[model samples]
Target: MYRDNLYRMEVPSTMPAHAFAPRNLNWNVEQGEAQDLAHGLEKSEAQALVFVSHARPDDERTKALFGFLRRASEVADVMIEKKQQSSWDAIIEALTPTLPLTSSRVLEAKMLAQAMTKVIESEDFARAADIAEIGHFSSKNPSSQPNRWKNSGLIFAIPYKGVDLYPLYALELQNGAKPLPIMEKILGVLQEKDDWQKAFWFASPNSYLKSKAPKDLLKSKPQDVLRAAETEAAGVQHG
Candidate 1:
């Protein structure tokens, strides 16, 4: 006696004739429909649903999308914060100490100093110091240190909210409270210009100096730096 065995097929048919063809997704048609629906929507209804998408935080696409959406929303108070200092602002800040003593100059110098401190901290060039510390380092009386450095042209005694701050890199400790020789020469070259212009010249990188910043090169290559400064000063004179 033989028993007939029966089993239900679990697998789907693999025959091409039995397969269903995939329908092509028409993105253009769907997008048009979405636009139509959005257009037909009331302002309140549209505002009720915000379709937000995000890209990488630093991506240009994300920034563009954010700008487009921000403009589309007619947002007047939305502020886009700048993460890096502009070249012009950096120059102005560097020159702040050179301006005539004034209340506004003090405030600007303070803000600029704070900004520069952040940058210098990152670069590890030199630590920024308040008047007292700079005075201690230079072995001068704390109260009159700013005046001493300013008179000697050793440092820019940047006035900040009724106080003075100095960038430590400006002075050469190895040589008895002396200003960097190059700085003195550069200052002489820049004597005719306003503090802002002089500051810009010192801080900005020069192609002639192989893109080295004048302030940074003051110690190692004073002569070459001084020549570059003279060239710049001449250009300013002739122009």
Candidate 2:
């Protein structure tokens, strides 16, 4: 009886046009629940189907997700191809001698400078009032006025483009516009280097300070940061 009924049933393609027409499907899938089971194959498929039913072609979130997935797939392909062809150690051994130490340092410096430029452009720097803004001129004389702040070592200026930007982190404002005790010590250690180099020293992550940048640790652990700066200075001096 079941086989006879099945034989009598009409095929989907042969059904009425309205019956075969695509129907709007809606699924009330919660984002948090879907995310929780995102890694599970069955749950992932269910989530995908839900998205497919609701997601429009022009959806920005869907576009970004697909774009990211595409890039990730491309990177995976490149990595897999490289792994199959040659090991990283073998490749490094082949290319290492061709690249000189000076060349490597120059490349590293260029990359670091580019990274620093991004940070500076993003306005992530601490607010430090300039000489004119601070209004602390020693005399009416223009020449001597600029020298007052420069000579005191109270502020270190980083030269970006044509302007000099001073980081305010070196100052202890709570103690009445005075320089932090360790600031002078750090400045002394980094005195021989240029302004940008000094900025990099303070801003770059320090291995001695457990990967925290010196500028960040200056307030909490100034002595330890200063010690690290001194060690770096010693290396620079000896090297």
Candidate 3:
């Protein structure tokens, strides 16, 4: 009797010998004789059906297959993350059906909604309560301080999910939680832009700053970040 490695069981002594033969060797054998052997040695059809129905995958085999699938899934996730924009585009393209002008506009709206959700849920930004905690606003109205900061042009916020979401990195934690000094200057450069636009500008990569987002370099390279913002404002004025 031969053991079937996949299902990890004896394949029944009645199974034809050619069933265990290597594919290449089996191919060279006489077809008629192989058929005769199969007809003579094969088990009853009921028994064969019972064997198939009762077969269970071995535990080790299942684990190995699961491990292989998990590793493949992880690799796919990393690739998708590395090429996020392209991956998103591909997914949208795949999902978007053939449509007229109105339907196409609806798809555009959906894409915009997805973009907004991503920005709102980003770890870089936080709600007023969280910002208050981080900035150490130990008052009854914890949100008021952040709002005051926003009103003063010292920082900007994005309104999402019925609340204002402030950029966490824009606060200088070491300086008594003061808004970063460069914020006002940057906001001055972006004065014409509304809160949402200003928030987008800070998060978007700038060519003048070697493609680093303005918020990322707020502390490490304030001057460069300011220059980038100025360059952007200049282009807008001219354009």
Error of 3 at 147 (Å): 1.2
The TM-scores, one per candidate, come to 0.41, 0.45, 0.54
Instruction: Record all residue pairs in model 1 with backbone atoms less than 3 Å apart, i.e. clashing.
Output: none
Clashing pairs in 3: none
Q: Is candidate 1 or candidate 2 better by TM-score?
A: 2
Indicate the TM-score of model 1: 0.41
> Per-prediction RMSD in angstroms?
23.5, 20.9, 18.2
* Span of ten consecutive residues with least summed lDDT in model 1: 3-12
> Per-residue lDDT for 1-239 in model 1, tens only?
22221111111223234222332221111111233345444332212223333333445664575556545443321221121235446777988876476898899999877665554443323223343463355434454655665677755544434555454555676544545656766777777875435555566789879998777777788888889978987998999
lDDT of 3 by residue, 1-239 (tens): 32322211112324345332222211111112223334433553322211111123344554565456445544553564457667667888999997666888989889878767767766878877877776778668888988999999998888876888888888888745778889888888889888877777887878888888888899999988888888888888999
Q: Cα miss at 19, model 3 (Å)?
A: 93
RMSD of 1: 23.5
Task: Score residue 34 of candidate 3 by CA lDDT.
Answer: 29
What is the overall TM-score of model 3 with all chains considered together? 0.54
lDDT of the candidates, in the order given: 0.52, 0.59, 0.67
